[model samples]
Target chain A: MIAILNAYRYRMLIPVNRTTRVLAGLTAALLLALVWAAASGALGISLWEVLRGQEDPFSVQVWWQLRLPRLLLGVAVGAMLAGSGAAMQGLFRNPLADPTLLGLASGAGLFVALWIVFFQDSGAGSLYGQFAAGFLGALCVCLIVFGIAKRQGGGSAAVMTLLLAGLAINTLAGAGGGVLAFIASDEQLRQLSLWGMGTLTNALWRTTALALVLIAAALWLLMRSARELDLLQLGEATAHAAGLDASRLKHRVVVATSLGVGLCVALTGVIGFLGLLVPHCLRLWLGPSHRLLLPASMLGGALLLVVADTLARTIAAPAEIPVGLLTSLLGGPYFLYLLMRRNRAC
Target chain B: MLTLHQAGLTNTPAIAPLDGTIRPGELLAIVGPNGAGKSTLLSMLSGFRSAEQGELHLDGKPLRAWPITELANRRALVAQQELPGFDWQTNELLSLGSNPSKSLVAALLDDLDITHLAKRSVLSLSGGERQRVMIARGACQLLSRCSPTAKEGGILLLDEPTSALDIGQQQRLMRQLRSWATQHHMAIVCVLHDLNLASTYADRVWLLHQGQRIDHGLPNQVLNPATIAKIYAAELQRIEGGTHGKPLLALAP
Candidate 1:
């Protein structure tokens, strides 16, 4: 008991394991790849050579200042979104469930549209303002989803009610964003469109710091309740008989995972589907034990995002395609494949 | 070693519920038609549902005070429906029954003649095979880590152990379970639909009528044609001199 407490106090936030070994290895390779791409400006050289002076006076100022921060931002956002997706899938017992379920992405997207209209210079260039609006938007959507679902029963805790609530909120937010987009100018339109697609081009230190702290705390809270998650999959009555406070466990997980997701959405306007895709693949590899699955999911999601993000940047040289586009383009067909497979099996 | 003191489970709270006690090593069979609260009574006693009016005790201590692991270790309940999405191999499913403190589950599977199914996926098994696996799981729960002799006690709560098995398989499995109970001195509370099976297998029977337990006694006394009719709302034909002839129940048109 003493040793456990000591380990909790002193251990590295991310524990090293076979899963983590692969994660760290991939992270190193991706980080190196990202740094190399930025330094060399491997595609269109003139467009990005403005901020590379951190390492040496002669080095291009754009490489160190602009590209490195964006890379880190992608890494952080990917991990958080993936973690959120993992939690959502586990909670719903549906492989297709994602961070977008509670309307966080649409909510964040709406706020970015409204922010771009109201605030001057509120794109990737001025990230804190955008992140704040995004967080508040997600937070507000969560409250609404919670209120609507809890009144009916409880969102995401009871699978059907949660799924319905997600669908309802997602539709409402999408409609609201469409109306907002119709009213804006060409510049606002362009900014809103890119934000809707999501990017990690503007990760400032303070706001990214917020995401790191909030997400780590959230993941920690969720990880502590992994055993309860295992018992819960057995069903509520069984979980209760097994001496778990089922309602409490469900609420805790929702908060931890949702908050982690909210922070990620705030950082990178609205990344889609990593959470759903990563956990589903991980569950097939690791069994349903949350203690094993959650950590493995985090690494798997991060690796998937790294590979996807690398492709996103490299696929189109001069103009970087939004990472969310890659996820949507890739994820939808894969999701369809899984759905058909499950239907056939059933 | 189970006692439910004036326990009440009411669809409407005004109705008075039944009270009962099941002693250690006693095979108590609960018999009633559909919706007699037979399953409800079993569920309450097994800690599936909370009792409103009275307390549930295991060996004189309150049932609520026991931790989940300890409670699970002591009472092994086979629920009514088949639990789906079980991806375990047959032996692994049986091993789940083993308490962490006990020996491996191989002994029970060996005794039950399920050793050949050790590597087979439990989900792919037939109904009779599945029922046997469920029983094997409950049996393994009794002896997982330590070599628990038949003397070391535990409780076996079966809602309908032989409900799906053929006559021969049902008789074989119940006989094995009865022998295990006799050797171990553990309480066995089984909810049974078969009157003849109860008469032949159970030491005592608890008969319920419309959510009320009307009688609970030795099988011969409880299996009377009139009492059976009162609970089942049908006339029963009593046969004499059959295989282990007790009482054969026939539905009257």
Candidate 2:
């Protein structure tokens, strides 16, 4: 593992600087979070027991069947959320842009509600249908918000209009999901509620693997556009005048963000505030250069979500709270603090 | 030489079709009344906008045929307005051009008298400071394309570079740009609202009125009161043979 990491040390897209040191620190934090999460769950399997190869059937099942998949899913979902947030922030050149704030999560949730109420079936095809519908719904909301923002002239007012549009869509999607819940049968309603309050308890190895692959693909696409994103901070006309095709860059970022956020919501329901805070905090420390920001945010998000998920399951002792609830419970105040700080600075 | 043969936009004929050539080792000031297409002309020369009517040739090659990166290496533009979202340091912002070169960046900072502001956040700069930094960035961008031992001959397009600058900084910037052009055989095209500054430094002057070319010649021939009144529609008195041996115009109050 160290050898693999060492290979990556020299192959980073950006030059090695203080930001690289910050990324290394984030990686260490993520590793620590993984170990803490593996040990501190409801089943109470010690890290030492797993490391020492003690193979009691119950502990072995808890270790292999339960903790591992949940942690793996956390890593995938967290990385996707944070990476997408970083990309969205870069695309809009606004620090406040994120999947949850932009209605992507609720959009996906509304479609998932539709799948649960109308298309619920005990079959593999039905499950895939939910994922596809969720993906399409997320993409649709993203495009709608983008279209509205662009129509408002895409000037200094673009960010304001985007946030307002996102708020309206989130309210609409919430109302739609609520209506679906009102009509759902008892069993379908229970499933929909459980999905709404996100948890990694339902993670399977196959789905975890797929989510990881999708997150990695999205991160790769976002990272490829890092240099252009940096230039775009100078504004569109300047970026274009400096030889970048600004419109093409914006298009590519939008498509990549939709795919990334879509897969994340489909995988983990609505993991609110993870996307917003991970990149915003990292940008506060590392500055707005996307080259370092994207990678560091992925690691930071994985660390934050894993730690939050661990607390979620362990704090309530076996009767676990939703990981999404834990994230918002923690991240909401932090986001408010950021907004207040921005106001103070202004 | 960069030659434009009746090059102009057709969609918004705000700029009439015009012909001109920008030669190496010359500083050409484009002076005109408001809305007379000075900015449009600068946009065309910098290849930011394509002219529908005629051809623009660079080194005997068509302008549109040049790849973006290739064109970027050969030229740089300092726009009239800058609105960056981040608090990037001046040096960092300057490095975002096609080429990022440490030596070139350092030399530009020193030459443009912005060396002290190198580490300062661009967000914290005053308007004049930002304008100087932008010009320095453009110069560094042009210098980045030069071989270490070769003298670079790059085109610089400055659209109202002096608007935000104080009188002292403006004079200093123009003097340095003039010397730099002569020393490096660089071709420069600047749009100036101040007619005296145009006459004082420009090797030649191109005057436009209502998007049409009214005059193109040496500063003396272009800045006389008759032509100034004809285009600007203001009564102006001229003081000839200033310290720079060029005409200076003032309102006849």
Candidate 3:
């Protein structure tokens, strides 16, 4: 059966060749975006000159100190958010599931707001402090959602319960962030609002390196569960009979998403919609197989963020728009289109 | 082989304790009225739900004691109304976990009369077509993983295998199941709603009512018109002289 299917897939050019083509295309696009992003900043450093060892020292410094770290951070954060989104959708077995929609990003954002409001001046505004706050917030929300779903028992009902719980948590976190914002001093408020809108403005080698390690580890774990996730699409009971340890898969997804997405929110604020948009687009083009979707989403997401961040900073040169705002602006309409298409398909 | 030693559930809509052994090369039909714990019994038998009151043994060991992968290899369950979450091809769906060879898959699909659906998306198939596809997948799961020297083909448990099939398709499925049981030396159990199908196809019949097993024996003896009518609380007429003297049941106008 597998041989016949493999032959059919080859004839249709759907699985193997398509996966290779999509990944290769996305990787090439990402490299282009990286070069464009690295060279298109305010100082206008010429990457070609730098490569040829003929660029001015100041331009090299600007590229090394500022653009390089920010670009790397953009790639890492984008991949983390998109990869988590794909994994969450697979875990929940819902095409529309995403980290932002499920409140992981907001939960992290809330704690970051709290940190800004209450501890910024007390030596707790360090990078590690921000990550700890964000991760704790995400973990709390993850536990609450999983706990409620477990109580509901398993099946489609549990998935619905988890989604509704996510909605409630998103609302609650938004309100909490509001309360913190209202009480924050003017200087603290500026920091809080800027961070809430999401940015890579704080990109530094130390923080970027930390985010890289954590996000890489999390993505690896998510990728490893691709086969189990495929079986889960048959529903939990059937998957269990097929030898899947579903509860263990659930735990892995929750921990990986919380850690990966929490760190993204901490380092780059709440970059909404990239997670939802990237994976959804890829799924449409490549079919819903996670073996390809996860890696493809990672590359597609990195390409998008690099381009968006470039446009964000260079569009208004010397006066930046938060990349998060740009992504939401782009993502909002695309998500609406997806909903309409789904309704039509039904 | 599965042995149920006073095994049952204690939850609402519970099943009363059942003591029985399902042996290879036999087709057992579990016939029951609404809310009669047919599905609940099947769940316990599949080890998806533990027997709250007693024990279920597979090959003389506790059902729960077998490693999950080994248990999966030995028994396959096709639950009712399964809708695939994605648009997987029928063949891909069959090969999800078991890794069946091409010949085995083709043979299973042919037996279930779904060979034409091999490359079609499961989501695009009709209800009856999808039902057959899932059954093929279940059989593939067992056949692909069965050890070469094992005495019996693994057990195949099906929940309402013919609920969506047409009468002709239903007859074909029942015959195919019987063939699998006998030819492969498999133990097959089906939860059936149609008494006539049970009587016509099953080697043995278990009649359940309101969480209790009222009677179980050869189909001809257990499907007596008077006992079925009273237990079902309905007007049922029995037609004698069925194939091999099996009793056929029909609803009275």
The numbered model that scores best in lDDT is 3
Root-mean-square deviation of Cα positions for candidate 2 versus the true structure, in angstroms: 3.4
Interface RMSD of 2: 1.8
Would you list the clashing residue pairs of candidate 3?
A1-B102
Top DockQ: which candidate number? 3
lDDT of 2 by residue, A187-212 (tens): 98888887788777778776777767
Poorly placed runs, candidate 3 (over 4 Å): A1-18, A120-125, A147-164
Off by over 4 Å in 1: A1-73, A101-165, A182-192, B11-16, B67-70, B82-103, B111-122, B138-152, B241-245, B250-253
The local lDDT score (0 to 100) that residue B163 gets in candidate 3 is 98
Rank by DockQ (best first): 3, 2, 1
List lDDT for all candidates, in order: 0.68, 0.82, 0.87
Worst 10 residues of 2 chain B by lDDT: B143-152
Q: Relative to the true interface, what fraction of contacts does candidate 2 keep?
A: 0.40
The residue ranges of model 2 lying beyond 4 angstroms of the native Cα positions read A1-16, A118-122, A153-155, A344-346, B12-14, B147-152, B209-214
Q: For each predicted model, how many residue pairs clash, with residues at least 3 apart or on different chains?
A: 16, 0, 1
Interface RMSDs of the predictions, in order, are 3.8, 1.8, 1.3
Q: Candidate 2 chain A: worst 10 consecutive residues by lDDT?
A: A234-243
| lDDT score of residue A56 within candidate 1 | 42
lDDT winner between 1 and 3, please give it: 3
Candidate 1 is scored at a TM of 0.79
